[model samples]
Target: MNATVNPLLVPDPATDHILGPADARVTLIEYGDFECPSCAQAAPAVKIMRDHFGRQVRFVFRHFPLREVHPHAELAAEAAEAAGAQGKFWPFHDLLFAHQHRLGEAHLRDHAQQVGLDMARYENEMRDHVYLQRVQEQMQVADQLRVRATPSFYLNGAFVDVSFGLAHLQQAIEQALAKG
Candidate 1:
């Protein structure tokens, strides 16, 4: 029998930003960049997919900032980590994608405030670049996976090409659901 082996490895829940049930049948992982327009476009669709799938699918997001092209992406990802430290990761993440065009220092601060993160803590972490290594580690995982672009997705531990359109993602999810 010819079966496609799942190439993507399972991400650590302790370190990864995940949504939905831990025991969900399908796991969807996205390696994204805040400054990537394609990632911004996929954000809402990801949310919708999570909502629609409910407990059936678990979603995880990892940083894969293409720093050479996206000048602010690395810092923006760092800010998200600071927010995560304050237990506001999801909200801050949504805000980052919502305002992808405005990812400067000031804008990141604004997002931190909007998410109700403790300003002092957020500022301190950002200043220390505490999350830089975490972000870099995630990027290294992306490199290992040969993920060349923002918004690359892995479903049920297998890579799913969404470059054509996110509709393919939905189709893949549906197929996964059907199989189970």
Candidate 2:
């Protein structure tokens, strides 16, 4: 990676969890926690950006689960990764956030079943702690990036300092698009 590259824009060392169009002109990388209220609030804005921008922009979600604030965050991230093994990451991810209050181990299992994942495999993977290291690696990267909040974003390789609202995201995306 380039020395000048913003840490937030760097690909996470954990899972290859890149989201959005590959050839998009603008890239928005978000570092968020599954249990963070702010991140939960930002979810819809992210969806809107994806819906509106379509192929014009790319969005990447990286884990920055603040375990101190949200004890079940790491578990949530692991559950998502486990779901990824079955190509159901996004569905599981949305489910986690949508039911943040109910994210216990059993709930994770229920989600896995609801998403049509093999229960045996999901339970085995979850027990084996397959994705824990990956989730921790992402958290370490978040530390390197100095991400201290629930929802922090980097747009077009630059750190975006603002609230995680649709207008703020739109303005940042527009600026990034204008730059190119």
Candidate 3:
């Protein structure tokens, strides 16, 4: 967690929820909280960035739930991971952000079902606290990276230190794509 040395996202099969072509030239990893308002607000912009970049860039999302502030954040993250076990991670991820205002346990289960997950398995996974390991690992990585904010992004292993909104993010993505 040395501030002197920059921390970058490590490409791992276990945690990275890649949302584009596997061999994309540019990779954008986001450490975010589903319950964080800022993350919720930036969700659409993140989508736009992906759309704009198309096949050239790939995006990964990692969980960094701030439990003290957002009580449901950790569970929401775990739920996404659980859904991932059912091969429905992206749908669950999008559903959580789409329904950030309703992140209760019941709502999470509802979203799980909405995403066409196996209810029995989903319930079992939730009760068993499965997928918490993956979430915890990502949290540890975020800690080492000194990521203290939701909606933080790392493009091509560099922290995206830009302003809010589409223009800034778009510009950063453009720069990353160009640089690579």
Candidate 4:
């Protein structure tokens, strides 16, 4: 929160949804919500950062659904976890952000299907709310870290404020890579 000062509270790799190599020098973690507009904007920038940084940076996404504002966000996060259970987290994540306006129950099922998850299993898990605790745990971690917003990013353990614009995020990534 204090502009590159706060370190990540939980940088656990085993439980995170990681993109890029595990051994990458720079670790970028995003505490994000599916229905957040800012987070949706950040999705593409994150992809660009991954492409630009190649294997130099590893990206992790942690769920931080702001349920007060985004009614469907929490369930969407749960849906994403279900997709992740089927090895389709990133694709489902993309679809959710792409169609941010349509995060209703039906749309979540549609996205799950689009990501090629086993429909029967996905529905069962979703109905059972199997991944709700996982999602809530991540949100608690974000709260512990004092993350009050979606798309709260940390590069190499330091918070990277993308409040002004995502260019700041790119700059932080560049600076982090330069530090190594």
User: What is the TM-score of each predicted model, taking all chains together?
Assistant: 0.95, 0.91, 0.91, 0.93
lDDT of 2 by residue, 94-177 (tens): 888888887889888888899999899889989999899888887888788788887888877777876635587788788777
* Candidate 2, poorest ten consecutive residues by summed lDDT: 7-16
Ranking by lDDT: 1, 4, 3, 2
lDDT of candidate 1 at residue 137, scale 0 to 100: 90
lDDT of 1 by residue, 1-180 (tens): 013544346757778999988788888899999999999999999999999999999899999999999999999999988888888889999999998899999999988988898899888889989999999999998999899998999888788999899999999999998888
Candidate 3 residue spans exceeding 4 A from truth: 1-8
Winning candidate number (lDDT): 1
Query: lDDT tens digits, residues 4-109, model 4?
Result: 5444443566668998886787888899999999999989988998999999988899999999999999999999999988899999999999999999999999
Clashing pairs in 1: none
Model 3 lDDT tens row, 40-64? 8888888877887798988889999
Which residue pairs overlap in candidate 3's backbone?
none
- Give model 2's TM-score versus the native structure: 0.91
Q: Which regions of candidate 2 deviate over 4 angstroms?
A: 1-4, 12-14
Error of 1 at 65 (Å): 0.3
